[model samples]
Target: MKNKILLVLIAIAAPVFFSGCATDAHYVQTGDKQQIISAGKINSQDFATAANDASRNLLSMDPNPLDKVDRSPAFVVFSKIVNNTDQSVDQDLLTQKIGIALTQSGKAQIKIVDKLGEDYGNIDDFLNDKKTTRRPDFTLSGKIIQTVDRAGRTRRGTYSFQMSLNDPKNRAQVWMFEKEIVKQGTRDAVGF
Candidate 1:
């Protein structure tokens, strides 16, 4: 009797489990409907969305001012990026992506603020070469904030990505950008 019951249970459960997973598989974009979201940690799409926003703003900048000054684009030194989130995040994943996009667009250049290092060799060479080396007209930096709230069976999360471009020479912040991503669900397992 015990064996028959166990066998019957397994037979019923197996088909349901397999049938639940029978949807056709297909490729999906990073942030598309097929993407997975986890409540415990940051997701790749979150980073990608943030990167895309940053890239758009950085590239949209006018490179004309720097172009007229000679050849080198605006040289920027990375500033202190305050990670104001509860989770430990590798901030470079965000900054480096933006830096690459900015460099490729020819609108700005990225530099290390630290003055002492063998790494300075490249920047020094540019400064010495009249063909290159333009002082950074702007400094880029920002912070990320995550907030969570729970009501009944629903949970809500909001992640805010903020960035600012400051004119170091003038000691003024020129541009400020902020983007917030929010997700809500009846259970944490299904939300981001």
Candidate 2:
């Protein structure tokens, strides 16, 4: 009887001991179908999709500000991207993609605000006395909101990405867009 009990204990312990050794790690492309779908966090593809949609629509407006002027590339300034979600996100994922698309489309140039000014901290970069003044035709601002719900074993997370473009000269909103991305998963007994 003691031998029988020891054999059963080993049977149980053997799997547990080796389970921790079977971790699989590999690299995957962004937006790949193999990427883990979590109900608790936002993914990279979410940002890309939102940016693509907003940029596409923004470029389609009739009599768009970008085309009205002789300036081949209209200038723009990126303002705040307010994060109302519980998850902290880097804004560049969205802004950089949109900025690149706009630049590549030959429609706009997003001017980055220079914080160091003409001087460079301990050292200095004020070598050039000449200054070039460029003004942005528009400003971009937006907010991201999250909503989560859990019922029994099922959990869901919804994210809303909102964006708007405003004409700085007239202080009027020129365009607005929002994209909603949802992720759902059922909690398993194994706690994945």
Candidate 3:
């Protein structure tokens, strides 16, 4: 009778004990204070910060290349973004953010183009040669580079986000910007 009662008590208390130990899921805004940080890899917060900085600097240019275009909103194409980091990262995370900011600001329009500056339109349109694509005034390209340093158990990572705006007509670089983000933590310290 004692063993049976003990077993029943354990079964009831086990769930309550385990439930207290488990963490409940919650939603938080991007780049929140509670977001996880890693020393060896780029975080979402890092991408947001870099993209924000790039957009601000690009929009603040004195000459304002976007204004020099014949059209109200300049058409811009993304050429390529090279990733030199150790880990695989989607370049769209950075470009898409910048693109959204620029588009929302009404300064530039993003155009999808191939290497030859052909529009990536519908297959039927291409087959019929119904090319309504306008030549892009500017092309945007970038590269992400990562460097790491270690001292004992402490590890530090620095990521460089470099971008350039080029005048396709003149084939000259109109604007260039670089943002560096560094993160440091102990090897065993993984989460927030």
Judging by lDDT against the true structure, name the best candidate: 3
Displacement of residue 26 (Cα, Å) in model 2 is 2.3
Model 3 lDDT per residue over 99-147, tens place: 9988999999996443333454533443344576766777888999999
lDDT for predicted candidate 3 compared with the true structure: 0.83
The global Cα lDDT (0 to 1) of model 2 is 0.74
What order do you get sorting by lDDT, best first?
Answer: 3, 2, 1
Kindly provide the TM-score of model 3 when superposed on the true structure, using C-alpha atoms: 0.77
Task: Please give the range of 10 consecutive residues that has the lowest summed lDDT in model 1.
Answer: 114-123
| Tens-place lDDT digits, model 2, residues 73-97 | 8877677688999888988888888
Q: Scored by CA lDDT, what does every candidate get?
A: 0.68, 0.74, 0.83
Kindly report which residue stretches of model 1 are placed more than 4 angstroms away from their true locations once superposed. Answer: 1-13, 16-32, 61-71, 112-135, 188-192
Total clashing pairs for each candidate: 1, 0, 0
Which runs of model 3 end up more than 4 angstroms from their true locations?
Answer: 1-22, 113-132, 188-192
TM-score of each: 0.68, 0.72, 0.77
What's the CA error at residue 36 for candidate 3, in Å?
A: 0.7
